[model samples]
Target: MSSAALPTSALAISAAIRSGSLSATDVTRAALDLVSARDGEIGAFTTVTAERALNEAQAVDRLRAEGSKLGPLAGVPYGVKDLFDIKGLSTLAGSKINRTRPPADADAVLIQRMTAAGAILLGGLNMGEFAYDFTGENAHHGPSRNPLDTKRMSGGSSGGSAAAVAAGFLPLSLGSDTNGSIRVPSAFCGLYGLKPTYGRLPRTGTFPFCDSLDHLGPFARTVGDLALCYDVLQGWDGGDVACVDRPSEQASQELAKGATGLRTAVAGGYFRRGADPSAIAAVDRAAHALGASEEIDIPDVTRARAAAFLITNAEGSALHLDNLRHRAEDFDPDTRDRFLAGAMLPASWYIAAQRFRLQFEAAMRKVFSEFDILLAPSTPFSAPLLGQKTMMLGGSEVPLRPNIGIFTQPISFIGLPVAAVPVRVDGPMPYGVQVIARPWREDLCLRAAAVIEAAGVAHMTPSSL
Candidate 1:
């Protein structure tokens, strides 16, 4: 089957499969063929589970023949970041040392949820080493290139997840966001990515980067697809202590509201600073579409970002201390150095950051009381050229890797749900704006994103590749 003949959206694909217009096995094979033919240019998949995928697709077809009821995501093809366990593959987490570990005994909780929803898993994706870096330059596995422009970065550590959907290989993909992994890649790749409220979705069976900050969510070309995947993945899981025991709140039905009666504001002060012209314009466009004329300052966001940094460093370092002690040579030098510094941090710093984090969350809760949505730039700039380091920020040159998450970290620090919507621009590359909402209010974020999307201000652009 030609790529052009396949349905581009998850819902459409699922409907076709259910209606017998497309067989699950044929659709799955076509998607695998596309990955095999073009993924080399983008390096999105670390392992393409063709045999497993075909087997699953055949199962779906068998069920259909038996006249069984199908789930919402029946026959929809997708992939996940390498950190998620996949039953028989080593969960690489984008590290060379992890290659020595035994294959996983079971799939991650989210993967199981997707399978139960009738979604077919295509493979495991490439990502930043141990989810530490933001540039998507994996030292062990080759970097996952931007699908729009292969020469540019795809953004990390969920770079491959973003690239796969943007490249038209999949309609949906799962990724983790400890610090802007989902949003950064979404911004760069021109896709809608949801960084659901922390603890909103279960993280069991996924390799840990920062237990305190890590969040798993989905990437899709459309807001509807993102909402569908998120709703299906929701519910409590005892395996992950961080997973809150909350009832599943579906957002797919909330899209029709479209920012109606919602008090929206544009984030000013810290968020507006250090951004390129295009990045700020993207926020302005989204805000205008959402009727967010009011601008509000989030106090001490700079400090909030610092606290997030400390928490991430300390937690990530502790989890990998054993690996750092022994197989240091197998580690990616950039990731290893960050983990080393994190290990040496005084315990008091982590404690102080945790204290300040509570204060930050409280402050944000108050701000949310006044507004239903806050719009901010997803990235300070579009995708940077691959392997090209350093960029100008705030009238001075700054290291590129750490600064990419400047706008996103503060929001993530407080565990708020955010929908990163790609904003249309005149340039070749694309950037995005974050539609942020209060904790457990992913519906509001998705609603605001739908508003922007309906206005044609935020939508995914096809990749040139």
Candidate 2:
């Protein structure tokens, strides 16, 4: 099937299946065929559960034939970053070592929720090894290539999730953001990605990166799909200590409300300091669409980023210390070295960083008291070329890997919600702006993003795969 003939959004596919214009089985097969034909070049899938997908698709068709009630995402096909557990597949987490581990007896909580909502899981997608890298250059499995330009890097650790959606292999995918995995890849690959407030969704059964900073969210070609996937994944899970007990906030219903009665601001100072021209322009365009003229400075943002890095290193190192002591060589060299360094950090530094985080969160909360949504560049530039190490930022050359998450780390550090909305331009690759909101206020972020998308300032254009 031609790319143009494929359904562009999850809602479109679900609606067609519901109306009997399409069969769930046929839709699933087309998605599988697309992966078979294009994933060799894109490198998006780490595993494809063909048998399970077919079985689930058939079940959806049966439910439809019986005229039974269906969930919101019925008949939609989706993928998740490899860190999420699928019953019989060993969660590789983009690593060579974990391939030999025992299979998870049950699916991750989010997987169960998605399946319960009638979304078929095709399989696990690739990610950065142990969710550490910003560039999606996984050494164990090859890097997930950008769908826009095959030679450019898809941002990690959610690279596969973004690439698969952008390549049109799937309409939606789940990804984890630790310091910007979801937003970075979404920005680079030209998709809508949401990082919900910390503890908003259950993290049970998913592999851990940094427990404090890690958040699982959805990536899709449109903002509505992002909100749809997020709404379904809501609810409390006692299995996750951080899981917030709350009622589901239907962001899709609130999307039409737009930015009315909301105060908006463009992030200045550190946010604008090192951004490339395209990054700055993208933020400007998004701000203008939302009528945001006030530029607010987020105090001590650089320090927040530093604290986030320290916490990530400390937590990630503690999680992998046993492996580093014995199976060190089994890890990706790039990831292995970083873990090794993290393992050697002083105890006092980690403690101090944790304390600083509370201070930083309080400062950001004060900023939110005045502004409902803050706009900033998601990345300093668009996707960098594959294997290209350095890039020009603010007239100086800097390493590409760590700096890609420069704008994102500060926000996630305080556990704020953000919607990364793609801003398509005539440039070689598209960039995005972060629609940020205060803690537990993803509704605000999605609403502002919906406004930007409705105005034609931000939207996902399918890549020529």
Candidate 3:
């Protein structure tokens, strides 16, 4: 295949495969070769299922030869974060302890959905331990280095998902977002990531992390690809308690409707304070591009963030209580300490946080009633150095790990859908803006993102590496 064809978008690849202009096996081989050549420096994948990928690709080819209809993702190559259960592979969830568990009996709900749609899985990607990190530093499986700048953090716990797409290893990948895993990495790696409305996509077969807040979504190089993945992953699954039993919302079909008549606003108040100037500028550029002059403040956002922390701690601790008792030493020290602390939190604190969450969600709903879409900085700044501990936020140095999701936590805390669109900047690394919409209104978020992408204000320029 020509170099130009090698890095084509997922849609393009699918079309080519359908037309017999490209073979799925060849495309899969090229992707595997790229991963083998570049993953040593990037460390995006924890496991690369070469044989499985090739076999799946060959099946697609055979279907075409037999004149059978193909799925939308016909020959696209993709992967999922380690948390997802890939049949026969221990669902690591970025923890060493999980390696000892028996292999998964079947694929995750999303994995099954993707494969049925004809997208071959490359393998399980690396992630933050137990999905409790935002810096993308996995002590056991070294940090998934930033494709743009190896020294910088890739953002986590979906770091590898974002890094793979950004580095052109694959056109799409699946990731989970509890606080801001999907959006943060999208911001840092210059990819288009979707953290769909909480429960929009089923989380069955994925390891738990703050059950109330955890979400599974996709990372892609383009808004359309993101929407396509979202559409495919839609539908109800009785296996996941949180899965909404609603008909699939055809976001990709609706994307062409554009952002017309949408009431757009830039978030002010808590969102404006303590953000990096560059992050602020990116939001400004996006807001300007979308003709959004109105500024709205989300009520009690700080308290919302605190509530998220308390809820996450309590719930995550509860889920891992047994492991904490038996395999505490197997966890990353940071994760172990946080889980231990959470196990000690009073049940009253968790109850209060849940009660407060309802109030916060109500406030946000009112804001959504007035505005169709809201824009905010995805991260406070661009990717930080891998081992860097402190950052100058609002002129005060703060610990980097927790603060990186400062702008994202409050939004996800309320189960709002957000599309993280990378802002084109004149720096070595990239930054992004969040296009947020009310629950189940991912169409609005994606429409606004498509508009920004068309204007050249937001894009995914593949990393040079």
Best by lDDT: 1
lDDT of 1 by residue, 56-171 (tens): 99999999999999889999999999999999999899998888889999999999999999999999999999999788889977999998889999999999999999999999
Name the lDDT of candidate 1.
0.92
Once superposed on the true structure, which residue ranges of model 2 sit more than 4 Å away at CA? Answer: 1-4
lDDT of 3 by residue, 1-465 (tens): 533357468898899999999999999998988898889999899999999999999999999999999999998999999999999989999999888889999999999999999999999999999999998999999999889888989999999998898888899999999999999999999989999999899999999999999999999989999999999999999999999998898899988877799999999988888787778889998998899998887788899999999998999989899989998888999999998999999999999999999999888878888899999999989999999999988889888888999999998998999999999876777788999999999999999999999888885666335
Clashing pairs in 3: none
Q: What tens-digit string does per-residue lDDT give for candidate 2 at 159-217?
A: 99989998888999999998999999999999999999999999999999999999999
Query: Local error of candidate 2 at 120, Å?
Result: 0.9
lDDT, candidate 3, at 261 = 93
Candidate 3, number of clashes: 0
Distance from true location, Cα of 405 in model 2, Å: 0.8
Q: Score each candidate by Cα lDDT.
A: 0.92, 0.91, 0.91
Q: What is residue 159's positional error in candidate 2, in angstroms?
A: 0.3
Badly placed stretches (over 4 Å) of model 1 are: none
How accurate locally is residue 311 in candidate 1, as Cα lDDT from 0 to 100? 95
Please list all clashing residue pairs in model 1, or write none if there are none.
none
Clashes of 1: 0
